[model samples]
Target chain A: MSILKVNNLSVSFKQYTSGLRQTTHQVISNLNIELVSGEILAVVGASGSGKSLLAHAILGILPLNAETSGQITYDGEVLTSKRQEQLRGKEIALVPQSVSYLNPLMRVGSQVRSSVRKRNAKQAQEEVFQRYHLKKEVGNMYPFQLSGGMARRVLVSTAMVSGASVIIADEPTPGLDKVVIEEALNNFREFADQGCAVMLISHDIESALKIADKVAVFYEGTVLEVAPVEDFEGKGDRLRHPYTQALWRALPQNDFTWIEGSI
Target chain B: MRWQLTWNIVTFLFWKAIKMASLLVAISFISFLLVKNSPIDPIQAYVGADMLNVSQEQREKIEEYWGLNQPVMEQFMSWSSAVLSGDLGTSMIFRLPVSEVIGERFLNSIALMSVAWVLSGVIGFSIGILAAMNTGTWIDRMIKWYCYTLASTPTFWMGLLLLIVFAVWLNWFPVGMGVPAGVLAEDVTIMDRIKHLILPALTLSIIGVANVALHTRQKLIEVLSSDYVVFARARGEKGFTLFWRHGLRNIALPAITLQFAAFSELFGGAVLAEQVFSYPGLGQATVEAGLRGDIPLLLGLVLFSAIFVFVGNVIADLIYRVVDPRTREGKSYAVKQ
Candidate 1:
């Protein structure tokens, strides 16, 4: 059963194109995806392909310029903006893309502790930190004090301590080393194993494939195919959509080139 | 770790003190040069129309008394030595010790400036927050227009306008002077002083409000749109809770820096406003000393103002570190039990 479902969502806005002239810039259109219980759905797309917009849209944190139309049902009910606010950081949590998402002025411990909605916040944060191999003293440090890898772990810990039913990790592995990347991927897998729905948005399809149960190939602001992870192996011929097949063939370990095919 | 944080603050303060002391020495020397080079004759200005009647013998005696007969360097040395020895010399115009005059007038200036300073910072900060939170709205535009217009207006002109309207036309407050006429210092009540101070202080604060409000609005807009703030909002924080938790401290650091940097502007405005309203503060004394060639009084005022502005900035920097945990380089603001 789907714990979170986004059906036919479209996001567009009007902006001034020239002197007193306006144009509608549709960044995402007719997008649909779902997060089911105890599974990792990796949504892969190129940069500027509305990957992050989908995440923002579902969280109801889109910019004011954006106008979104769609039905987003969470936990068997339509998720309104008001309901999103109540569930945010409690029933549903987001692991943002950049370390900049951490408040520079706040302590790492306090930041994660604030996310713990139901439990002794300090103990929950400490347990998560220990699981990630972060030092006890790291809790007192600011975001800037942490290395690239520690910062990412701290971000994940913030979500883990929340114990949310659905966790959305957005572009979490960019600029990270292989070791740290594997650790972060493993952390997301653990979250899904604990019965939470996890949506991992990333442009690095290769990394996403390592832990993802289902791979959703997004192109032209819409999902071209949602196939099981095994379908991506052995030349990608079993993939239903031509774009997904091309994307798989174009991977560095594969063809490294995207061939034009039937739409 | 606690010990280290405390030690760091002490070291910071010590260095600031050393810097301020050296700056004071430089300021005093330069102001001395500027004062000595002035073409105005101290004796002539001091005697007024009686200069022609005074014989050469009387003139020599007067010059000798004030050490004007000595060489420039020698005069400076005498003044500097006296200052180093805790004496600010005597005011030639007022016939009292310079320190005594400064102390009495500084009390009055402090009252006016403190009222103006607090008023401007609190009111301007509130207005700035309102404007930033309501960006692209009429309230934002109105605040921007008001700040821009007031920033370009002269302090004295604003003083005069308020004088004409509130004090003259509306008869809301006293038109001028620091107190009621013929009232002894002992007889003047706090209410009387407040009534007289209202107009001049308002003039100074109104001018100050423009710079602070505009700066705060710009800074807060950037802060509100920052990534962390967006993330915090996505974390179910909004309205005053979001602003209080995330926005306040970030803008406050910059606001404080701007507020302290405005001390010189505040003092400068007070000088002009004092002349307009006949307020018997240090600002009024400043102009009189400069125009009358009172070296003791003029140098004294310059030194006092330099220290005043410097101390304000030092306090501002200290407060910034206290308010902003990032400045301490990962030293946690709170200790876990």
Candidate 2:
């Protein structure tokens, strides 16, 4: 059964124009996807394809000016804003993209521990830190004291200790070295193997294909096709969407070809 | 490493002291130069034009006695050296030591300004947070309008208007002066002093609140939209928890710096408010000293005002260090290397 399901989701922003005039710009439309238990669904798309917006929409953390339509279901129930608030950071957690998302004023350890729902939050946080290769003393350090890799590990640690069943990581591997990227992806794989759902949003198709059980090709705010990981092999024909086939062919190991037109 | 950090702090303070000393000398020299070049004669103002029967010998004697016969540079050197030794020159008009005259009024001004500062800071920050939280709502628009209107109103005019309404029209507060006549300093009740203080304090505080509210509102809005705040909201932190823990904490350092930047304006507003209320504070004394061409007293007041501004800046820097651990960590890291 699907742990999370989004159906025909649309997001538009209302903005004021000259004088009393108003305009609505639809950024995302008719987007649908699902995450099953013990599976990793990676949403792969180019920049400005509204990949991050989908994650934000799922989390119900969109800006006040944004208006969203359609339905998101979690655990077979309609996920309203109230349910989003209730489940967020408990049943569902986000691993944010920007390192600046960590509160500069807060210490690394306590920040992670603050989201722990377990009885032994401290022990859980420290164990997660150890799992992420963060030294015990690094907990006392503020976010500004952390290097790029260490900060990324800290972000992962925060999501891990949240005890949430659904983890949405938005472009978590950009700007990271190979070792850190492998570690982060391995952690997500381990998380999925434990019967929890993971939504990994990324522009890096190569990294997404590494751990993703299923790949959903996103283009122009909508999912073009959702293909199983096995179908991605020797692509072009197995991939249903032309864009996905083009994307697979564009990979350097494949034909290294280029596609025309912007999403 | 600890020793190195200590050494850094000590050297920083020593350098700050040296800079402040040189700044004081430069300010005093410039003030003296302006006073010396002015057409008004301090000695003439001192002796008074009414003393027509006084002879040239007596005038020459008075000039000699006051060391007015000395060249401008010589006079400045003597005055600066005396000031360095903690001796502010005698006031030409008051016929008392400048220090004593300033000392009497300094406390009163500090008391008045302290009250205004604290009141405005609390009220303004609260309103700014509220406005930021309710952005695009009627409450936010109302507060924005109120801040702009209050900020544009002149300090003296606001003081007079408040005086008329609260003191004259309603007879709720004293119209002028810091204290009522025949009220001894030791015998004055807190309530009595508060009644006398309300008008000037209110006038000064209105401007401060308006300025701080506008600045803080803008800053809070920026902070609330910052990446960390968004992340915090995603973490399920809501409302006041999100506001004070993340929003207010991030905006505090900038807000403090902005407050210090507005110190000069605050000082000017305090002076005008004091003048309008006839409050016997340093500001009132400053104007009296300037009008009478009391060169020694005016120079002393100028130096004091400059020192106050410098101290405000130093306090702001200290608060920044306390609020931001990054600054402290950077210092330690630098010292380690």
Candidate 3:
């Protein structure tokens, strides 16, 4: 069953050019996507393709200047702003893109513990940290004291300990080593296997495809294709959109050829 | 390593002390030179025309006694040595020890200014947070307009305007003065003193409140848009929790520094306010000493003000260390590394 659905979503920002003169620029237009129970759906796109905007919109965290039009349904009910606030951090958690998302003044353990909805929040946070191979002492450290990999793990643990049914991991694996990235992906897979859903947004398609059940190719603020993972194999012939095929063929393992146009 | 850290802190404090002492010396010398160069002679003002026709021998004795006959450098050396030895010299106008006069007035100024500072800080911070939370709304625009208007108005002008509206026209508060005349310090109740204090304190606080509010609003807007705040918002934090837990904490250090900067202005405002209101504060003493060409009293006031500013800065630094763990740890550990 689809746990989340977004239909005909469009986002535009109003900017003032001069005194009392304004213009609206549309960034995302008529986008449609869905997340099902026990699935990892990765949305892959280049910079400026509005992949992050989709996650923010779903979380109801779009900037005030942005105007969005869409029908978003969660759990078979309309996901109103009130409902988004209600579900956020309790039922739907996000692993934000920037490590700076960790509060500089707060300790890592408390930050993770703050997101836990379970009774034994401390135990859950420690367990998450142990799973991520973080030292016990690391819990007392601030964000600045942690290395990049450790900070990323802390962010992931914050979401993990929330016990949310749906997790949105936005570019969570950058600056991480190969082993850690694989471990994180496996954790997501294990998480989804327990009947929760995951939306993993990233530009690194190769790593995303490693665990993604479905891949949605985003280009120019709209989804070009949402295809099964198997379709991404073998010279990109099965991929429906030319942009998706070009994206696949341009991979270093495939043709190593550059796509002609800039995003 | 622990010993080394302690030693570094000790050395840092020692250097600061030495720097303050040198700055005080420079301030004293400059003020003395300015007073000496002025057309008003302390002896002429002190003796008055009644004593002007006294014997030349007696005049020489007075000049010699006051060390007015000495060269400028020698005069400074004598005065500085006297200051170092705990003698602030006698006020030529009041004929009292400069320390005695300053000590009495300093307490009064401290009472007035501290109350104003606390009042302004609380009101300004509350308004700033409210304004930031409602950015682009009419409330925010109105606060911005009020702050800009208050900031552009001169301190003395604002004081007089408040005096007119609240004290003279409405008859709500005392027009001026720290306390009622002939009222014994022990006889006056806190409420009576507050009644007298309301107008001057309010006058002194308006500029500070406006300044703090504007700065806090600007800083909070930036901090609210920061990545950490957005992340916290995504964690289901809203309203007061978001502001108190995240917004205020981030804005605190900068706001405190700005508060300390505002304190330097308080002394300047206090002088005008005290004169306007006939308040017996350090500012009034300063002005009287300057007018009377009382070099010793003027020098003492200048040095006191300089030290006050320096101590305020030091306090700000210490508070920063307490509130910000990053700064505390970085200074200690990074130095060792």
- The TM-score leader among the candidates is 2
lDDT of 3 by residue, B221-337 (tens): 999999888888788888888877788888878788777766678888888888877788999999898786777788889989998888877777656755676754543322221
Model 3: residue A14 alpha-carbon error in angstroms: 1.4
lDDT of 1 by residue, A1-263 (tens): 78999999999987887897988899889988899999999999888888988988888988787899989999989999999989888888899987799887778888888888899999999899899888898898888777888889999988888879899999999999999999999999999999999999999999999999999988988888899999998888899987888888887888787675532
Interface RMSD of each: 3.9, 2.5, 2.9
lDDT (10s digit) by residue, model 2, range B1-337? 4575567567767887788889988899998899889987876777777568778898889889878899988988888889989898889878999999899888889888888887787788878878988999999999999999998899999999999999999999988998887777898788887888888998888888887788889988988888888777777888888877888778777777767766677778888999999998989989989888888899999999888888787767766755577875553322221
Give a tens-digit lDDT track for model 2, residues A1-263: 69999999999999999997899988889999999989999999997778998989999999899999999999999999999998888889899986799888878788888778765889998898888777887888888878777888888887788878999998999898998888889989988998889999999999889999999999888999999998988756888888899999999999988778733
The lDDT of each candidate is: 0.89, 0.86, 0.85
User: What DockQ was computed for model 2?
Assistant: 0.58
Candidate 2 chain A, poorest ten consecutive residues by summed lDDT: A254-263
What's the CA error at residue A146 for candidate 1, in Å?
A: 2.7
> Between candidates 2 and 3, which one is better according to DockQ?
2
